[model samples]
Target: MDCDLICNFKKCRKRLNANAWVSIRKDIFCDDDGSREFNKSTTCPACQTSLSGTYDIIRVDLQQSEKYKTMVLAGQKPETVIDIASRALAFWTYQITQERTYQEFVTNKGKERNIQMEQYYEQILARTAAELTALKTQLAATKKELESVKKKYTEATEQILDKGRQYQKLQMLYDALRRKCITPLTFDMGDAPVHMPNRNPSNFDLTLSTRDSILRRENNVSVSTTVPRSPAEREFLLTPGPTPLPPTISDECPAAQSRFHLHIETPNRAMSRPH
Candidate 1:
């Protein structure tokens, strides 16, 4: 087939050049009869292309079917079409494989993030628990200290109250003793006796002589003597046996007599009074 003629035919039919054809004729001679004959062309009449020489044009036409006509009219170039088809199939297969790999990677990353979040939450819980325990310990210690302080205050208050009671008791005793010491006295002063005589005597006579005798006898007698002396004997020895009276004893001499009387009265009075 001529390439130019095929190109012209494709433009007219709006089809590919590869599918165009042409026809040819064959001549034959018989040896005995010496006759010559020409065979008709069995190739395609429009494209002038030959068949495989196994069948007539009528049989080929019957086998060709509508599928071959559609394939020719689609304008496919043989070599270029093969390369484009192979690349398209390979690219689709690669895209399917990459999609599966990307899905697996995203799942793994999600799991790692979940684990990290769980660990962080656990750490926060542990720290919070420790702090609460420490605070409880401190509170217990403070309570014990407060109880000790309250006990001490109670003891001190009791001691002070006891001392105050003792002081009150002492004060009561002091007041009682003071009342007893200063209580008023109640004696009978009207019955007491007077020592001085009611009237002074003028006589310095026998009564005076007798009192002098008795006083002298009492002075001479021992305190331990058991026997009492007769009054006459006591008078006989104590009187100076009527010796002459001193000039001071005379009644006419008033000054001398007064002096003698005073001396005699004082001695007798002191002796006659209680020992």
Candidate 2:
């Protein structure tokens, strides 16, 4: 009936006899029934560590000592071989337990690291996507601005071309005026005639007078029969039929009546002249 109990602590495998075992208890109150019950735990006496039901103790029977000695025959007795085997068994069990715990610790640490790496990569991808979206918006805005600028430039260019064409037309008109290529038309003044004799063609001067002015200044009439420098001053006489002229009247003067005669200047003689 003699037996040895091994401590469950892998690092502290203290052995105990059957006499060292004790029952630890606590009384708990159940609120539903208002009843009391005893809660029990079996613990190691030397280490004071709580032991699970399956790992509480390792028991070795002293009755099997003779068989262990026959298997390990080195002049060793039965009790010595049993003692060596019990310690060896406890040691190998501790080694296996410690190895399993270390492997679990390593596995949990690797799982945490993988979770952290995955979160970091997700954050980077999200940031990259946001930046790409912003760049696309900016690119679209820039393209629209470029199109607007192009439209404005096109309108301004068309306006400039139109102004250039207008300037060309004005330049042509100015050239025609300078060359005197265009002629003005002529018109008749009245039935009365004035005289201007012994006058130089360069110094000849003419004035526009109404019918009343010519009739009032009959004797002192000064008419100039000078050609116009440019035809812009004359008005055109566009009639449907030929105009008839009155007969020339004879008047005697002391100055030069016999020398030269002044007559009414008609539009026919003016139009018949060469340019």
Candidate 3:
């Protein structure tokens, strides 16, 4: 029911079994079966051109039309030059389409990445500006607070110095008063005996000494007239010490107290003795 057909075109002249030929009757190309109905058309496999009535159709034994059988019997058949060219053109077209698609994908992806990077940079700049503004505000507040603290410190320092000056003035006045109180008293017992006939007698020599000297009456005799040398000594001059009480004044009269108060209790001996 099938035949072998060859293209009549001298430039092509490719041969193929009827089953492998194009069929115009059904508008379907080659099929696996070799059911060759009459009036079926075919094209040259190399040129893809119709060779319908122009080609010769030779009746072929079914067993001989089998491709594997033909190959085994005839070894290998070489493809026509046009067939090789056709395949090369098809492969080239496919490669071109695939390359164009890949290029489009890469270009679109690059554009999207660039847009995202620009947006990210803008966001970063905005955040930085806000943080910078906040820092400036904080710095200004800190400066204000520092100035306030400095003012308070200056006022406090001035007050402390003023109080210290007042304390020093008071201390100097107290020392002056104590010095005046200790000024020795002078007496003139002209041509009279310095001694008195009594159970207790006056210890004063009745002789004139230095005007600024101190006079301490002890055992009815004049004692030392030493004066304070330093401000510390003057301050401590009135402080009571662990010295023995005068026998004549056992009730006790501290030197510092007597100097500052201007009041000294007369010794018991002086009070009891007759003048």
RMSD per candidate (Å) reads: 36.2, 17.0, 17.3
Misplaced by over 4 Å in model 1 are 1-104, 181-275
For all predicted structures, in order, the TM-scores are: 0.32, 0.39, 0.36
The whole-model lDDT of each prediction reads 0.46, 0.49, 0.50
Per residue, candidate 1 scores C-alpha lDDT tens digits across 1-275 of 11111111212322222322221221111211111111354444334556445432211121356888677436778776777677645544443444455557778898898899889988988998998899999999999999998999999989999888767655555554344333332122222333445334343233545645654554356333345444433433223465433343566765444433433345456445553
TM-score, candidate 1, is 0.32
TM-score of candidate 2 versus the correct structure, residues matched by position: 0.39
Ranking by TM-score: 2, 3, 1
lDDT of 3 by residue, 53-123 (tens): 63332333323447765455353335654565576456445435544565588899999999999899999
Top-TM-score candidate index: 2
**Looking at candidate 1, what is the lDDT of residue 51?**
45
User: Candidate 2 residues 1-275, lDDT tens each?
Assistant: 11343433344444443222222211111221111111343454334556566534433332456777566558878798789788666655554565456658889999999999999999999999999999999999999999999999999999999999867766665654444432231122232233434344433344567544544454233222233443332322224565334223346432233223334445455344444
Ranking by lDDT: 3, 2, 1
Lowest summed lDDT over 10 consecutive residues: which window, candidate 1? 28-37
Which stretches of candidate 2 lie above 4 Å from their native place?
Answer: 1-73, 77-83, 181-208, 211-275
Instruction: Give the Cα error of residue 45 in candidate 3, in Å.
Output: 28
